[model samples]
Target: MVWGRTEEGEQVPKEARVVFQPGAVWPEADVHADSCELVIVIDGTLEDENGTYPRGTRISAQRGTSHHPRSSGGCTLRVLYPDVVEVQRPAPPVAEGGA
Candidate 1:
């Protein structure tokens, strides 16, 4: 679901306050070729490819990248998306499993 809308009443490229219950995970990853995203863990733990991010941790997903966010013990997150799309594609494979 789209989060808060702008003063102009648009949901695209919006800011969101999301809550993940214990063991909850976001099924679809976010993908945008021209937009980056910012994720801030407000409480509990959030895990992703980079590793587990504890409360107060901040993460940024670069443009053309994607990630599935999961929380083992619940979490609150503040996120900024340039544009939240209906479809999310997996991130491109790495080179030789590195980077």
Candidate 2:
């Protein structure tokens, strides 16, 4: 859920509570060009290309950074985004030995 805006009429950023089931894979995506993202692990474990994060872990993804998040045993995360981020999905792998 997104938080309320600031008294000055500026946005207070967006927040989300995400639950990832076992074997869940979140696609790799770039952080918004003008915003950074913060993530806190609440339970279980979350893994990305950089490393694995367990409960109580805090992650800061700067603007223009990318990550592919997944969970092997389920996880809960609190994510904060400055604004709605655009996802950039990776290109599908080409099939081999076929036309």
Candidate 3:
């Protein structure tokens, strides 16, 4: 849920609680172009290209960074999007064992 607003009168979401089911993958690619994102794994585990984040782990993604997050065994996350975010379609999955 949105918890804050910007000075320019925009409804900026300051924080969000996200629940991921088992083997769930986020559909969009989040590009933190305007602000950084702070992610806290509240329960279970969250994973991205960087690494696996377990419960109680806090990750600070700086501005201009990007990530496609997913959970292998379900998880709850407390995400803080400090400002605007650029959402892009997720990259096509790579084929296994080469063409």
Candidate 4:
């Protein structure tokens, strides 16, 4: 559950917490900018490309970084976002007279 943004107001998320069922994975792995996200494993196992994180493990993702989090045996996570609003990365410059 997210206690950051409500139905009204600034629409900025301050903090978030979630409980993942066994074999559950986050739906989106989109990159985020201008936001620092931290994930703490409360129980079970959390898996990422780097390795598998067990209980009491904490991972920090700084601004302009992204993470893909998943769990095999279920886990509880506590996340925080200093800046809830995400900034999109700028597109590459087009070539001169390119198709």
lDDT of each: 0.75, 0.79, 0.84, 0.74
Instruction: Record all residue pairs in model 4 with backbone atoms less than 3 Å apart, i.e. clashing.
Output: none
The weakest ten consecutive residues by lDDT in model 4 span 1-10
Q: Candidate 3 has what TM-score?
A: 0.73
Model 2 stretches with alpha carbons more than 4 Å out:
3-13, 28-30, 82-99
Q: Is candidate 2 or candidate 4 better by lDDT?
A: 2
Models ranked on lDDT: 3, 2, 1, 4
lDDT of 1 at 3: 48
* lDDT tens digits, residue span 53-91, model 1: 999999988877877788889999988775444334469
Worst 10-residue lDDT window for candidate 1 reads: 1-10
Model 4, 1-99: lDDT tens digits are 443442244455566677889989878873655467788888888997779999999988877776677888999888777666433447999789858
TM-score of 1: 0.66
Candidate 2, residues 1-99, lDDT tens digits: the string is 765343354554467799999999986564455457899999999998899999999999987788889999999999887644334347999989967
Better of 1 and 2 by lDDT: 2
lDDT of 3 by residue, 32-88 (tens): 765688999999999999999999999999988899999999999998877753333
lDDT of 4 at 38: 81
- What residue pairs clash in candidate 1, if any at all? 13-82
Worst ten in a row by lDDT for model 2:
4-13
